[model samples]
Target chain A: MIRTEQAEVVYPNGTRALAATSLTFAPGAFTVLLGPSGAGKSTLLRSLNGLVRLTAGKVVAEEADDLREPHALRRHRRRTGMVFQQHQLIGRATVLANVLTGRLGYHSGLRTLLPFSATEKRRALDAVARVGLIEYALRRCDQLSGGQQQRVGIARALVQEPALILADEPVASLDPATAERVLSLLHGICKADGIAAVVSLHQLEFARRFADRIVGLAKGAVVFDGSPSKLGRAETLRIYGAEPADNDEDSEEPLQLKTGTHA
Target chain B: MLAPSAGHIGILHEHRRAVLRHAGLVGVIVLVCFGALWLTGFFDAQRLIEGGPALGQLASEMVPPDFSRWRAWVGPLVDTLAMSIAGTALAIVISLPLALLAAPNTSPNFAVSQSCRLILSALRSVPELIMGIVFVAAVGFGALPGVLALALHSTGMVGKFYAEAIEHVDPRPLEAARAAGASRFQVITHAVLPQVLPQLADITIYRWEYHFRASTVLGIVGAGGIGFELIAALRVIRYDQVSAILITILLCVVVVDSLGAWLRKQLK
Candidate 1:
């Protein structure tokens, strides 16, 4: 479980990126943060993994105040897998190699010098299979499409077997179709592995369709927190500065994505 | 009424960028003044006239090439190559640790990194020829002293390159490794090593080839190499032997250059 209590972030120049906002995500829950640009959505996601230090208040993950010390926070970060909006995959490395980086916490010393152990290699391969990129494991990550690269990012996170996954605007750069597919895979993986997921989204439609629960933030504070069905036009207007389309307006039902298959 | 009330804007914005440009011009003016002060009274026509006559006299002594002691020069050329290879090898071994310690981002303490850089700067401050003379006195006149001198000089050079290489590496991988709970050593081995290894190889080989040429010159001070033979040939007025030695040195330099090129390509 990940929780933030009145957590606030102030930049060095006194820009308050996140205000006194508090949020909690249940275990195995797929929660989406819906907001517009500069709404502190990314800041909130970074706070969960202790990537962004809180100027005041506490960030608790797995029942510990994560923003305690620099070194201690780093250890907590290992348990939480983070996906950047850019995918942040090391493009030069092979897909398998990039995925195996997720297991860095498990090895030390000359163990890392030698080739990764067979069991660890198997686990990494299993993650590639789970992401349905087993065929491209040997290929370089730079060759993959934007959607495929995001999947590789998911594969990297899956390899960690993390307790919680924080994806900051995971699909903001992807196309609509590709965005839906990537979100579906992320949702399926989180559900299967029982990992709490906090995915930030700029698109209200994708968040509404996929997120198990939706949280709205405006000016670094949570304005609404409830089920997707309960997210009304008033909250959307407040979060987005414009009324969003009704959730039931779309004809398609909720998507059921396969583990390794594209929806 | 608003259309008829347009205010005249002054030339205030015209000189906004002029301030920085004038600052740069002032900096150049200061440098020129210092350069003029430093170079004042350094040139003399009479000294050059005297030096020119001496150079002509020296040139007149060399009438023809005499290749009599080709065998004698060959041994020393081999010695030069051996000295360079050994010195570069030793230099690489010593500099790797010093470079890692000197990298500000990698080292834990600022003082340690600063001290490491200071030590390298001190080593580099002394000329290689002076170092050779000092080593020869201590070790009693052998190729070992020459190699040690070159190694010490090359250590400073390699350490500088290593520090630069460390600086140029992408910080993202290191950040990720730190986030992954990797120990300092693990982060270095996984994140730092892979990124810089190929570049390290390229620079190391290039330095080795460079030192190969420098080792020949170090032999002039009895540090041991073809330079000793060249000096002897000049003293004996054996221009042929000098020519032979010079040709061999040229060939060796060409070979070293090609080898450097090959190694660089291989690394890529």
Candidate 2:
């Protein structure tokens, strides 16, 4: 239900990070944005919440105002949630308190300072439970594992009860097994909640294995868009510009170089 | 091991020469500064050696402090504690907003941040005693001047610490709040404040301690505290009363410091 229409983003230093690209995201779909680093993946995700502005174009949602207006933009962002690569939880605060922060935009400043209502507290706890961290609700974020901390990040987003969730490389710092687990959990949550998600990742195998639709970016342009089954060796070669170092289909080595050098 | 290469030896020799030169320079600078102090009679050890009897006589007079004048000393002791408490409370109130404005990441604009920093630096450049004298001149002698003096200087000290703490907050949490549709103030309250609260409390408590010590001496400039009473006793040659005042101030500081430490531990 959300789409970018000929969106372009140029940095202040004149780097055209995103060329004019038009793409529509379907509701309840787990879409993976696969690209090398600096391929405008983060920039594109950030724009969904108005964190990054489009230099020329419009980001719109059906039955809502154009997202370019400042007033409407903030309202749009309130309905959209984002997960950062870093866990981004306040390490000094309890996990439950961190999740409660997701409701800050909905409440008045005076209200936030006093205390949460019983219903709000229950919903925050529910979000924590949904992320499988209800046992750690009172624990500080610093004590949690990297994977757990990322789950707290997901919980924070979930508490917002957002319509659209944009995750930018959410599992880059985890081990291969943990990465698989978190991605599967994220995909399952999106389906169960009937919320659409656009997850950007550098790993192609996970994208192929988890995504209902795949949108590949190379050189800041969408090079491939199709079902996950269509993303085979030929598609990988086109996106990566070469056969991977060991494209044996089973090696756990990362598909794209971490530095994301173009072949 | 084989002999090292000539290039390596040459580099090592160069390093040794540099170290020797730096040592010689530091030694010469110390000698010059020490000679200057000696000629100015800043501290003459030979005079101290010769004045043992006078020093011993002075030390002997301070013991068994006469409590006969204790009734009069109580008012000023209480005044000193009150002055520091009020001043520190005032400083905390003023410094919190100024610190947020001065922090690079939290400031609304570059000009506003620079202005806040410059204003705080100007306040810090003046010593509390000089500030005490100025306030006393304006307000006419009382605890109010002492409180104002301590509050201004403490605001400078605590505000800088607050700005640094705010600047060091993790950017990711801030970004998350922004993406969650938080306004500027909401982001600061929800994300930035939680991370920096403990360190900010520590800095504020430390400034309170410093203000307590400063308030005790601020009365020497006629701003009204234990220092004023001690100076009066000194003029009347009542050394016993001066010792009583010193001991009272010491007890109060120790008790306050202990309470502060306990509270900080609880916060941790």
Candidate 3:
């Protein structure tokens, strides 16, 4: 299990992005960090991997070295895969090449200068196949649709063979249907692999549908943490500071409880 | 109402002052331009009119071109081409690391970045011709001096352009690479280089085209190229031969430019 201990992020400009708070993520569990924009959802997710250096606090994983040191941090990162909102693939590079970059951390920097080994190639190809982008493996990423690109990003992350996966607004830019499909794919993969996943999302429906447990935040503090079924109207108000205008249509069934169906 | 009116008048006064300040700056610029022209004797119409006949005589002498020494010219022409290619290749080799050091995103620290930038600026401050003369004096002439001059001068320009390209790359990819546990060197090779490679190629090709022309002139400083032949022709008052050499250089430049354009398209 990975956990933060009073982790906080105060930017150089003196903005408290995440207040001192602690949270734990267990193996084989899917946790969704649910909040509105500027609610510290991203900060909390990034803090787990040290992407956002904690101003005060520490992130510790069971049986791992201290994360504050550079060597330990890199080892932690190698075991932790991150999916970005922007998809972050090199546009001019082929899908296969981008996915292969996930294996970069596994080898020495100079070793990576040469072509990857056949075993590494096989792993990347398996990842591409897993993400259902096998046909587009040789195609440049820039040619793919937004949804397809995000799948490539997933494949890139998956090739790392990480124990923990952190996705920050992974489907924020996709359309509603595509977003749902992408999230389902991610959820199914993590479930089958039993990799811990902490995905941050502003979309109420997605968080409700997929989260094994929902951790809600408002203004840099965790307001609610419980199973999806327990996140009710009162809890939503506490997390959002007001009724979410977009969820009025589905307010009657706030927690859709679609988690087990996909898994 | 009175207080609001006073504020409006104050804004109006501020706007007028700003306009006057801009106008005064323009006036000074124009005055300086005219003063420069006057100092350079640009307004001397009498001298220009008197020089017209001499220019016509020189042009007349350049006609009925000589190609008798065409066989001897071939070696120097090849040397010019070789010097440019070698120089540009050398510059690119030297510039890549320097650019990495100079780029703010990739540099190890502020001091290194600033120092690299200072070096680039210092190198670029000297013209290629001046560098050629200095190299000739140091190395005792020949194509070696021309090659060194071109490489050093191009390194300054190419490194600066390369650093700018590196600096402006999308930071998102770099962040993604770092988050994946890739080392600094790995991040640069995998993320940074891919993004900037095309722009770097474009800059390098453009510089090569420029170096081809510059190398020709370096030959005039005893650096051994077609310019050496032109200079020799000039010394002997062989105007016809000089004109022929000029034509040869122009043709070669056109060929080099076309080659550059084709290479650019291939890269794209």
Among these predicted structures, which one has the highest DockQ? 2
- lDDT of each residue in B60-118, candidate 3, tens digit only: 99998888889999999999999999999999999999999999999999999999999
Give one digit per residue, the lDDT tens place, for model 2 in B1-268. Answer: 8789999999999999999999999999999999999899868878878799887877678777877877887898888888988999999998999999999999999999999999889888899999999999999998999999999988888898899999999988998988888888888898999999999999888777777788889989998988889888888977777787888888889988988898888887
- By DockQ, is 1 or 2 better? 2
Which regions in candidate 1 have their CA more than 4 angstroms from the true location?
A63-75, A242-263, B1-64, B235-237
- Give the TM-score of chain A, superposed on the true chain A, for all candidates in the order listed: 0.88, 0.91, 0.92
Instruction: Supply the global lDDT for candidate 2.
Output: 0.85
* lDDT of the candidates, in the order given: 0.79, 0.85, 0.89
Best by lDDT: 3
Cα miss at B183, model 1 (Å)?
A: 3.1
Q: Give lDDT tens digits, candidate 1, residues A1-263.
A: 77889898887876677888878789988899976566688888877766677899888776355668755565677777777678876666788887888788767567877888889889999999998999999998889999998888888777777888888888877887888888899988888888988999877777878788999876677888999999877877777666544432222212221111111
* Model 2 iRMSD vs. native: 1.2
Q: Can you rank all candidates by DockQ, best first?
A: 2, 3, 1
Q: Clashes per prediction?
A: 3, 0, 0
| Per-residue C-alpha lDDT of model 1 across residues B156-251, encoded as one tens digit per residue | 888888988987787766766655666677777777877788878887998889888888878887899988888777788776667777877999
lDDT of 1 at B111: 97
